[model samples]
Target: MSVNEIDEQGLGPQARRSEATKRALLDAALADMEATGEASIRITKILQESGVTNGSLYHHFGSREGLVQAAIAERFLGSVTKGLAVFAHRVGEVGSTEQLFEVFRDELVRIGSPDVQTQRIHRMTALAAALPRADLLERIIADQGRYFDGAADSLARLQEHGFIRFDVDVRAFAAWFLGLSLSRLLSDIDPQLNPDNEWSEYTFRALVAILTPAPSAH
Candidate 1:
């Protein structure tokens, strides 16, 4: 199920090579999605761009939808996990709740922006899966669940250590954070959703405020 599992099961070498090929295919698909924010992406172009063999593609992912799901899961999960790790680390490093939240706000904005067309399209496709393939949508949600649980674990640790406020619900916050991100994904389709590029900043600040302890009066 995981990379480690693949290694432990005696499929390490082949899995490692296949993983590289998978990354190439994902990167190629991203390039296509970035170029055009279309959900119905062309499979031939991705194969050509990645130079992945037809047999290999079919072997690794059985269907066009499967390939799309794998690529989206890998890319989106990587970013979510990476950003959450840093945010949690920063939480432990900072003393005050304000300082900790500043770190979170910065991470939120940074991760959400610099507007890469590829990422927007990738997100649209993932969200689009909800309509045509409920099964695929479930897979994407499950993929995110693993990373969100990891982040919630870190938050629980911080709360236990008194780095974060004890009253805050870590898992709920993670769900809310992800829900906000998905809602923001629609902003690309209709800028009306974002309103002024302030959604990330505003939401980050609001959520952190709720999670922080009430300041002690002098």
Candidate 2:
């Protein structure tokens, strides 16, 4: 069978052996995709690198496209969960809302690019757009909404504590910050470009300038 014609469809594992193989293949795919962005991955390369037979892959992923989508979702969703958890914990830690916002902003700046956090956003958004009718696509939108809500909640907490500007809509600001961060993340997908040159303290300062108000104004 041609590498391109691998069977696509079926997560069911009737036996332990089947389950193990499936787990290995999926794990391999997730690792590969995370190392080399989803935009430029190939099933053939995956199989070659993963050392799994086409049938093994097919039994797990069903098709090349399905495998890619699953990998993308697995890799990105896992990252999103962790990111939210960190933000949530940090928000709860501070004695006041203002400190929470400051810490959050500092954390955002502290997170180095390629901003896998934002890369997941762009990756999944593009994937869902390409396949709008898919059930998974709807789930992706829901996931993004939750992500936005998380950001908004953090912002709201900050606003409540008098950190973020009360006059500004926290949700809107959160959305804008999310969008901008994702944009910058996707734009810097290639590492050949200088990572430090385009994004650094200056970039974060600009982002803070927009999302936050001056201390004097507060």
Which has the greatest TM-score?
1
lDDT of 1 by residue, 1-218 (tens): 55665665467766778987887777886666555543646788888988899788888888777787776666566556655677667765776666767777676666566553344445556566544667766776786788678778867876776667788788887887766665665564675566235766677767767787666576
Candidate 2, residues 158-207, lDDT tens digits: the string is: 66766655687766766676556555554456767654456555556665
Model 1 spans with C-alpha error above 4 angstroms: 1-16, 37-40, 115-121, 185-201, 214-218
- Report lDDT (CA) for all predictions: 0.68, 0.63
RMSD of each: 5.0, 8.6
The true-versus-predicted C-alpha distance at residue 165 of model 1, in Å, is 3.8
How does candidate 1 fare on TM-score?
A: 0.72
Q: For residue 64, what is the lDDT in candidate 2?
A: 74
How many residue pairs clash (N, CA or C atoms closer than 3 angstroms) in each of the candidate models, in the order given?
Answer: 1, 4
Worst 10 residues of 2 by lDDT: 4-13
How many clashes (backbone atoms < 3 Å, residues ≥3 apart in a chain or on different chains) does model 1 have? 1
Model 2 TM-score relative to the real fold:
0.61
lDDT of 1 at 146: 80
